[model samples]
Every structure is written in C-alpha cells, then in structure tokens.
Target chain A: MSNHDTHEHGDPIAEIKKVTIILSVLTIIELILGFWMIGVTSEGGRLAIKGTIVILMLAKAFYIVAYFMHLKHELKNLIMTIVVPLALFIWFITAFLSDGNSFRNLRNTYDPHFKEQATIKVEAKEGHHGEEGAHATEAKEAAPATEAKEAAPAKAAETEKK
Target chain B: MSNVTTASTKEAKWWNGGKSPFDVEYGKVMMWYFLMSDAFTFGAFLIAYGTVRFSTNGWPNPNEVFKSYPFAGEGTNAPLVFVSIMTFILIVSSVTMVLAVHAGKMMDKKGVVRNMILTIIGGIAFLSCQAWEWNHLHHEGAWWGMNPFINADGTASSTNFTNFFFTITGFHGFHVFSGVVINIIMLIMTLTNQFEKRGHYLMIEKAGLYWHFVDLVWVFVFTCFYLL
Candidate 1:
C-alpha cells in the first residue's frame, strides 16, 4: 500500500512534540476545571463547568485519535469509515440517560419508600469515616440502619396492600 | 482501442479490486475496527454507569471517596490528586508510544527500544497506582455490592457506586496490564532485531495503536467517574 509512502515527507518528530504539548495543555485545563468544580456548590455553575470539562475532554480525544493514532494521515474514506459509525453514540447516550431519568421519576411517584430513603439523612459520625478503625462501630451502627431499611419497605408493602 | 482504455482505467480506480481503498495495510485496518469494537465495549460500561447514577437519587461524592493517595496521611482531604497523577502517567505513556511509532517509521531500532521501554514502565506504574487505589478503597469497606460512604448529601447510598467503580477500573486496569505485556514483547522483538530482519516495523505501529487506545479510554473513565 502507498500508506507508508504517503507520510514519508513530514517531520513526524516535530508533529509528535506539538501534539504532546496540546494534549498535556488540554488535560491541565480539564483538571483545573475539575478542581474548581469541587468548591462550587451552585447548581447552574456546576453544570456550566461540567459542560466545559466535557468539551475539553472531546478535544483531548480528537488530538489522541487524529495525531497519536495517525488517523489524520489516513485517506478520506478511511476517516469516514471510523467517524461515521461513532455517530451512533449520540443516540445511544440520549436514549439510555433519558430512560434512566424516567425510571427515577417513576420510582419516586410509585414507591413511597424509595422516595423517603433519599430524604432521610444519615447522621455523620464524629470522626473516623471509612477507616479501618471505624469498622467495628460502623458495623454496630449499620445493624439498625439495615433493620430500619427493611422495615420501611415492609411498611410500604403493607400500605400498598391495604 | 477506446473500449480497452476505458476498461483499464476502470480497473485502476482506488476502489477497484486488487488494492486497498484506504491505502493502508489489511492489518492496520483490522486493528482500527478491533479498537472500534473495544470502544463500544467501554462505551456500554460507562453508559450503564450513567444510567445507574441517573436512576439513583444520591451518589457518593467522588471527592470524598478518592481523596487519599500513596504516602498521604489518613483523613487527607485531597480529591482528584491521585487520579490526576494517574491520568498524567497514561498520557505521558501515550506520548512515548507515539514516539516509538515514529522511531519505527525511521527504522531506528535504538530509539524504538528506548521509547518502548519508557512506555512499558509508564504502563506498569499506572497499573500499580490503580492497585493501590483499589486496595485502599477495599480497606474502606468498598467493594462489589458494598459501599461505606454515604451520598453527597449524607443519605444512605446504594451499592452501585462502588460496584461500577471496581468493575470499570478493574477492566481498564486489565487493559493496561495487557498493553504492558504487549509493549514488553515489542521491546524484546526490537532488541532481537526481529523488525530489522523483516525490513519493516508495522508490528510496533499496531501495538502503539492499542496503547493509545487504552489512554483514550482513560480520559473518558476519569471524566465520568472522578470529575463529573
């Protein structure tokens, strides 16, 4: 194939260095956005930052595929062959996520126990969160939580039957 | 004579039989398609994760879950620090892989060996970091169907968070392990002058493609699980 001959003219090393810089810069931007996101508790602000992160993510993906994977040097038809099929992801993500949201709505409307569980906040222990030292006490505390969880569902079932 | 010329030109077209329309070799084409299928596999996993997260009312804040790194004191409040390091390692390895591919193109065996070794080291380091993170989380009572951390809002959380975390990262770690093995084998072949004898280094190119694909997947996983 002429594929080997096609890319023989360019300075491949220089191209690699350039793309490396681009990828790194993009990742740093993404991390900065991520760290900034952790401190922001506002809903709209978080959404906007998340949207920016996703955009940067896609840009990173493009660099990796187009440069690192050498897809840009390939023929037009070859690029199409790969890119066209990926369009399916748009539909796939939309359908799955929307369905998941719908399922949550349905559960909230129909299942009183499921709705109640989310509203009830667990009391935070004074310290020792998720540490080995806290395991004993955690187990002790979880026992009643489990019993209460089970009791809530049974009560919901009884109410439904009535 | 006109009929003969028309027939000859028709056969010479790019899409005509006896030549690749994409101008690349059959192996590279197959590799691309294989990576495409693998992409779908990972896509299915992350999408499934999204579905579960959407259906659930509360998710454990990832900042609370993945805060500690190696050598950090207990109860350190550093979130995304460890993961960003992991992300950088993978990206640097990917850059090394690209360099190796370029070296292979030049038929510079020493350059190929050097870059491949660096790539392999990077892979192993990334895998080790993953192992530490997994072990640490397990110590915190996180596992399949078990979650110690409550939701971001303090409500009792579902087990799906840890479930997806372990399963997806485990699968990605497996890919990194296999990529490291492939790179080791490539390194050996380069050292042994296998590509020199073959008069081409197409094999390294293919392995580099796989390695870069692994890095590409991590970008998504990091975003979906840690950042978002």
Candidate 2:
C-alpha cells in the first residue's frame, strides 16, 4: 500500500524539500569552486582544477540521476540495466578523443594553412626586430599578412578537393 | 470452489497470460527501457563533442564563450552566472513535478492541479531562457563558429566547440520544451476529472518520470557545455 520505494509516505513533502535544498547548495559549491580554480594560474595547477571540476560535476550528475530520476528507488536489476550501458559511454568518448588528437596532428602536417600561420608569426617577428619603432609600418605589414592568411585557406581547400 | 488447492490458484493467476520478470508495473518498466534508449542518443552527441574538442587545440574557453548576460554587460564576458540561474529554474520545476505526483497519490485534485500549473510555468520559464540565450549567441556570431565550413577566427575556428555547443544544448532544450507541452496535457486531463475515473494517478507518475529525465539530462549538458 505504501510506495516506500520513493519515500512517498510519512511527511514525503518534507523529504523532497530537504533534497531540493541539498541540490541547490551543491550547485553553489560547484560555481564557487569553478571561480576559485581560475585564480590558480600554473599550467599543472590548471589541469588539477579541471580534474576537480569534473569530479564535482559527476557528483551532481549522480544526485540528479538518482533522486530526480527516481532510479535510486528502482529494483537492482532495473538500475543495473541502465547503469551498465552508460559506463560504456565513457569508454566510447575516450576512444574517439584519442582519434581526434591523431587527426589534429595529421592536419598540421598536411594542411598548408599551418604554413600560412607560420608566415604571419615570422613577419610579425621581423617587424618587431627592426628598431623602426614606427607603429604604422607594423600595422601595414600585419594587414598584408592577414590578407594572405585568408587567401591561404582557400588555396588549401582547392588542393584538398583535388 | 472452496476446496480448490492453493497451488491451483497460484497457477491460475492473471500473470499466466503475460510475463513481468521484474515484478513491477508494466508501464513503469517500459518507461525505463524507453529512457535507456533516449540516453544513448544524448550520449552519442556528447561523445562527438568530446572528439571534436580534443582534436582541435583552438577550442574557445567555455567561460569566455558563454559569459554574456541578457541586458547587463552585453559587451563583457562574466562567465556562467546566467546558465547557473537556468539550472536553478529547471531544478525548481523538477521539484514542482514531484509534488504534483505526490498530490495525485493522495487524491488531492486541487493540489494536483495547482502543482501541475506551477510545474508547467517552470518549464516555460526554462524554455524562454533558452530562446533568449540562442538569440543572444546568434547576435554575438557564435553560430558562425558553429558552421563547420566557416573559419571565422583565421584558422583556429575549427567548428569544434561551437558546433557541439549548439547541437547538444539545442537537443536538451527541445526535450524541456516538449516536457512543458506534456505537462499541459496532464493538467488539462486533471481538470477534466480523468484521473478520478481511472481511480489512480499512475499517469502523473509516468509523466513525472519523463520530466525528471529531462532534468537529469540537463545536468550532464550543463557540465559538458558550461561548467567543465
């Protein structure tokens, strides 16, 4: 007679109110941590911050899926039926991400666009090299380089199509 | 008939005509299966996003990308405060949905009607927030980066971050929008006394399952697109 599985008995309203407060507070903690991580500027420290954010996020995901989705009250078999396949999704994303890294490296090696980017850097450096402290000449030099940068991508596309 | 064996009665129960291995309501079990399939679709979109983001080093910072508020600081990037409010709205709506289901259980018709209305309002509010976000992002040329063919940032705009941003969030937003429509239908049915005729409010519970699914999916979308 009692839907005890969902805690829908004996002050059920109070139970849900408590859950709401908890979820809201957790979200606040997440936002604060995110901004705090911003203040730490070391590259290695940044990676640590990213990992912590991910961990906090997974905790939020757990509460949402468990209490909100009511999966926490479902029978063990049904819960496993959903959770097992979701685990595979993590593996799936990792595999694809590795493949993406390979493609990025390959593009840098093969795409002529990389060459154009390099040319801009070289020109910018040369302009800075001469004490010709004339800001106007540097601006003029930067204009042609950027124009070439735009034209360069179109040429790469043509070669790619060929 | 009085002398019938207990074994015979057990064998003759109505389940003899059908199977329920999980020993739960048929409708609820079916809803679980449906949610699993839907989860797979969301997972695939997010996985594609991960692949693209990983491949391109030129992906824009999420904080800088999503930091604009509606009217204030239209030119500045103060990251995540607006979407955080959006998250709160959806969660509050989810709370109202649960309360509606609770009312249905107690056969409190007025309670059900009031809570359903509140839940529907919450859903509409979330959808309105999304429409505003989409309009703002469009004006800011975010969609231009989403176009795979358009390299707006010289060479770093590789259609990686922007493409997934629109596709994943847009998909979640569509689900929230539909949840609102379904809630409105449930509200109308409650007003018409349909649940009274049925003698139970399992329909509301089913819809609650669906609305919760929408909220759950948003948690992941918020993490993937905004927080992390």
Interface RMSD, model 2, angstroms: 9.4
lDDT digits (tens) for residues A35-89 of candidate 2: 7765665778867766776777677678767776667765566687779978887
Give the number of the best model, judged by DockQ: 1
- Give one digit per residue, the lDDT tens place, for model 1 in A16-125: 88988998999889989989988999989998999999999999999999999989877677899999999999999999999999999999999999999889877552
Maximum-lDDT candidate: 1
Tell me the spans in candidate 1 whose CA falls farther than 4 Å from its real position: A1-9, A125-162, B1-12
* Number of clashing residue pairs, candidate 2: 0
lDDT of 2 by residue, B1-228 (tens): 322222232344434545343434778778878888888899889878877766664544566566677776535658788899899999999999889988988888999999999999999988988999888765443452332222213233444566678888888999998889889999999999999898878788888888988988887788777766
| lDDT of model 2 at position A95 | 91
What is the C-alpha local distance difference test score of candidate 1?
0.83
RMSD of each: 6.1, 7.5
Off by over 4 Å in 2: A1-11, A105-162, B1-19, B144-155
Q: What DockQ do the predictions score, one after another? A: 0.39, 0.25
Candidate 1: tens digits of C-alpha lDDT, residues B1-228: 333333433244667656577767788999999999999999999999999999998888988888999998876889899999999999999999998888888888999999999999999999999999998887666777666677888787767898899999999999999999999999999999999998888999999999999999999999999999
